[model samples]
Target chain A: MGGGKEARRGDVLLSGEGLVRRYDDATVVDVDSIEVRTGEVLAVLGPNGAGKSTLLRLLAALEAPEDGRLLYRGRAVGRDDPELRRTVAAVLQRPYLWRGTVAGNVEFALKARRLSASERRERVRQALQMVDIVDLADVPVDTLSGGEAQRVALARALAVEPEILFLDEPTADLDVSVRRRLLGDLERIVRHAAPAIVLVTHDPGEAFALADRVVVMEGGRIVQAGTPAEIFESPATEFVASFTGAEFMLNGTVSKVDEGTMTVRLESGASLEAAGSAEPGARVRVGYRPEDVVVSLPQSSSTSARNRFDTTVAHLHPRGGLVRLRLEADSLSLEAVITRHAMEELGLQVGTSVVAQVKATALHVFPA
Target chain B: MDVLVDAARQALALLLSGDPYLWGIIARSLQVSGSAVALGLLVGIPIGTWLGLTRFPGRGIAVALVNTGLALPPVVVGLFVYLLLSRQGPFGELGWLYTTSAMIAAQVVLAAPYVAAITLAAVQAVPPELRLQARALGAGRWQALLLHLREARLSLMAAVAAGFGAVISEVGAVMMVGGNVHGETRVITTAIVLETRRGQFATAMALGLILLAIAFAANAFITRVQQAAPRRRRPLTS
Candidate 1:
């Protein structure tokens, strides 16, 4: 890797080589090398405690890795450089606003640079308008609700007009509707501003919706990094499939193997048959997407699907046009997403009996 | 109860009569305590901020020592300062003992730790993210410290108030080091002690009333600050 000759200016805004961060005696983030290109949104997607946020911090230069070289503009620099800080801005998860009016919080970064008062005011107004929160400018930060506060925080970051924007789980704490709305707002802002961005999130949908590229991290290492389509559809690792909620991981053991299909007994003792290579008496893990699982009433119909589990509807919630159901079958828990119209037709309710139907090809089985 | 009433009456009378002697004692008390707390702030705020924000080897021990210093016995501090300035001690040539400087030094020992301890707790109470956010938004180390201090202003003000209150109301250290000499080392606390020992209960009560007023004022000030959303600042009118 002749980094000096190969590195091109304006293509990559920031890069890290051999980054390592540890906490509680565990190396929570250990990336060999990563880069953020200009005018692209790179989303770091991972499950809870997967060190996604730590990677964001390292990339943003907020935390100096114990062992690593952080390079800016293809040149290594001190981690705490004021110039570097000035060029980058971040909106952390559950961001805290300074004790002042919304406008005050927005102007803080500007003030550090000693911008003219008129310039600061103009930028603050523009940022607030960008987030559609101009009316909230005079409101004190503490008085704003969670969604409104998050918008204010975004406005504060945008007001800096930074070269790079780092957003760590920006919408994770928001309500579903609010998160969607904010994501839409962010897409619009990103299009207009076109600054390099590094977004850390736990949801694959969010990464697909808002980022140009997705990097999947697990157990402190980058398992895969590629276009969102590649990550969501053709994930390089099963951990990415399980983490993105694209698939549900359930513990199961093989009951028997006959012909080409393997009968695996789930935690609830219910058996499922899938086209897999696992042998008899072998412990295996099952993975399938909620959208692939069909929720049908018991005795509604008989289908050629090889796997059907007798389940009781434990809970259900609306997810846009679909309804997410949490079904329980004794000792096993499963999730299924079906259309609202189907939900109304089936008349599914909590404690109602339903058999979850899945095609044999949909289940991806792996040795436990 | 009657003795208390009579003492209050005498306190009011002395205050109303424009007595210079009592005023001198009060002024001297303020001078000594104010100087001690000022020095304490100068030395303690930085140390406390460092302790609160940074992680280093033996930090726990340093923090434990600071908290312990919060409850430092004034008499013990006074004895230590006294020995440091005593004729028999090593640095005795400077001769600070039996003087107001000696009282101020001892009180500084008592007050600086209170300032430091409170500041440490206050800085730690502040959200670590605040400092991180500040630094991320182009603030240098000193700027980040200032920003964090502004966020924890309530705790800092409380620390100052506690320091002042601790020193102004303390009697043991100043008595041991300053010797309560009239017109020189005698502050309100020592005067009150002297008056009470001589059975001049009214004078002692009058001095005690002034000291109580100071304490009450300090408490009221802190209460007002704490009650305010963050700090005493007019809304930006631009």
Candidate 2:
């Protein structure tokens, strides 16, 4: 078993190479290639109708591909292969409980494998305890709260002790607090169980917090795939940049370069320094997180930073504790996230001229 | 109006007198209809479940045919069964004509399609996600089928009840096939016909009332069974 574990760890547990599933003229899933490595959580993030759920279904073998193949453990598997089926489990967006007590749903998968009655009972107990719903075991499944039902569904999947777990919007309908708790519990379980998890979610924070790597899908194909940090820091395309909420895009010419840092002169005549290696004359697209740009009243005798510009506030949108100030300087439009306290102290309003100060390390520059 | 009231009073007296002939007819009706419903359920449920679960060529046509069977007239079925089971007919050598067996056989034909069509609709009503979830949990196709059937059991019971109701009340096929023999083949409906034709209005009216009561009782029993059966739960042991 140890040798088998090592061999399996090196093997790709789930692989979809050139998978294509189309409905009439609409393609639901068109993947060039995607692989879930052993014990890794790969979150597939996309907007609604972006084919994330469809990809999970294709991986789970619930649906057949119109074209291409899905392989498990270096062998081809269709929707009917018993060995492949045993190694994979999925929690759908809306889980169904078989008519029975909560204990019954959890025990179903174990019983399917023909485990002894004692073994099945033990497994079901462990699963129920893992999801913190052992007390609800005797309760009828239909009477469970939404969160409780979802937990039972998760427990049912875990009872199988699968090698791969697919979660398609597991927390899509859950409230924020419940979602956080479940996600945290799930992260712990995935770490301990060491199953390759493929989570499809629309929540950016959930993806960033739980996934070791994130794959962004749009219109039935993968747009980008990388570590969350890599994807967030330097998005490969405009779509990724925008989808990940790195929304502000500025075109500029490099004015100065020093040690992997470049000061860019925007077309709006504002100067911004970014952490990138670029020649002095190269044109580049510079981006920044809204939170990275600070808005404040003009300060005299301040330390000279690489990027600072005085701009009029075009819009002030308050969101929670943060206020997003859309500032305009000539043709340059930048968004800065300031605290409500800061906004109040600075007496900021739309059309009020203020200094939009940005840290050089906070800006990301990519060649045009 | 006086004569109608006198006839109704006479009918009530005959019914209260516990006539042996009327009891015999009632017994025969129970025997044939009960056997028919059992046979129909045995054959129809599995076929309906299979048809609903498995995707095959001509599946739509098959379902359509079964749904069409739901509206099949009893007289037409009686004619068809009579042609097949009568002397000089294809099955004449079996010596099954004008007997309880022939009645049961005819009623089975009438009831089977009712069972099949209702069970099909019941199975189809189960959400596809439930099947997908079962499959994802490493359940084989057979296991998924069992789970889906368990989930749809209530509706399936209602289908069975409908089929039972259909078989129990049907008279055309049994009359045509059984030949209404005096003791052996004479059932409630045929006996009623015989008494009415003989101008034994009291006995006929009494048999008619008893038959209506039997039908009502059978339906009430089925409904109570349906209501008493445990609500569908995802089966733990399957």
Candidate 3:
């Protein structure tokens, strides 16, 4: 599950081939192929308006594709297929709750399936307990807070015990702390319920945290799909790199090529060793995560990191639980995130001179 | 001023003593208007909900046409009903002119558009995502539509109240079609008109007060239903 191209866990529960959706004159979703296997979480990650939500709608059968074949369990199906409706459930960013008690809203899913009263009550109770909102079952949805309302929405979806769950930014509108808590609960539920889930969100952290495999979309097409580590470690395009939070970028020219490694002379006149295939005299952009960088005082003992740059701390931003150091070496700038304890131990301050180190393996080189 | 005081006293006596004639007129008014509004709701709500949810090339014009019906003159509707049921008219063989059925037909025409236009507004006021969410939660098409209508139930009730208020208080259409027959067709409004024309100011005033009371009660009911909708609370930040 951690490898990008590893064998997936279960059989294909749903698949869409050559899906295309258009609105007015703009094509919002155009995918050649996609599949959702049983007991796996597939995340569609992208920036805003990248068609991730649209693609989820297409797969959820909330909207039909203009041209495509949608197959559920190898059988062709339309949006109105009773099998699809019976087996699938979805929760959206906005908690579109009904005008009723939380339990009443949760029971709606069971009622729609024509479950008996006892079954509905038991399922509704269990679903509310799963989301840890059992006490709010009888509370009116309108009186509940946003986070609580969203929990009711999730409970409603889970009450059906669907085989496939579609979540479109369920926590997007929640507060950070509330969202974190909901994500934790959702993660546990996914592990316990083990339903095939398709999660659509612009938040990379959410995808990395929940998804077994991710499909990054851009401009109405799936640009890349892989495991979380693969997506974070080796992005296929610059868009993926930047969108995945690869913040440290440096422009350089290849000065020498040896074996499989290349030496790049940066525009700041700092030569660095990186592992990539490139001919001499090619301009390239090198990207790395801020967490990969190690910063130290100039008088420190030597470290084994291959590429080092003497930089000045230009700006210090205190992020939650960490300090982001904006370091500048002549015209080349790089950001490094370290714990607040490390910053205090090093006595780092703005305008302090430090040496930033990066291993050659951590750098990703792209043709400029 | 003297005539007003005398009429107020006489009106209270007639109302308190349970004058059968006045009571009968009130009953007939409620029966005719209630039936008209009920029939109107049966025909109007579905069309209004459909118009609200559906999108077609001429939808704007259709909505505009429904809204235009909201302003339809009761007298013109009365004339139209009269022509359709006249001796020389198409439905003259049934001879429904100057009858309660003809009056009901005219009021239905008056009330349906009123119901439809308001119902359309009410259905449209509900967020479209609610329908989508209902479908995503495993509801069939009719089930989803029912959920949406349930969400708009308060407004739909207000539509009924408004429709009743419009048709029950109306005199022109019912008078033209029912001919204000003494024992059968003389509703509250038509009876008030007759009393006023015959210089019976006290009876007219008595009947007018009863009509106003009925209108006030319907309006009060509408207000309560409208305000019964839960108020949105401030969103929690944490």
**Per-residue C-alpha lDDT of model 1 across residues A223-315, encoded as one tens digit per residue:** 999998777655555687777665655678888887878888877676777875677788777887788888888888476667777889999
Clashing pairs in 3: none
lDDT of 1 at B52: 92
Task: List the pairs of residues colliding in candidate 1.
Answer: none
Query: Candidate 1 at residue A294, lDDT?
Result: 84
User: Model 2, range A57-167, lDDT digits (tens) per residue?
Assistant: 998889999998998876788999988888889999987888889998988888889999999999889888888899988998766666788899999998888888888
In the range B184-221, model 2's lDDT, one tens digit per residue, is 98887888788889988777777777777766875786
TM-score rank order: 3, 2, 1
Model 1 TM-score, 2 decimals: 0.80
Worst 10 residues of 3 chain A by lDDT: A1-10
Off by over 4 Å in 1: A1-10, A245-320, A323-368, B1-4, B86-99, B220-238
* Per-prediction DockQ: 0.25, 0.44, 0.61
In order of appearance, the predictions have TM-scores of 0.80, 0.88, 0.95
RMSD of each: 6.4, 4.3, 3.3
Candidate 3: regions farther than 4 A off: A1-8, A299-304, B227-238
Q: For candidate 3, lDDT tens digit of each residue in B114-192?
A: 8898889889999999989989988999999999999999999989998999999998999999999998999989999
Considering just chain B, what TM-score does every model have?
Answer: 0.92, 0.82, 0.95
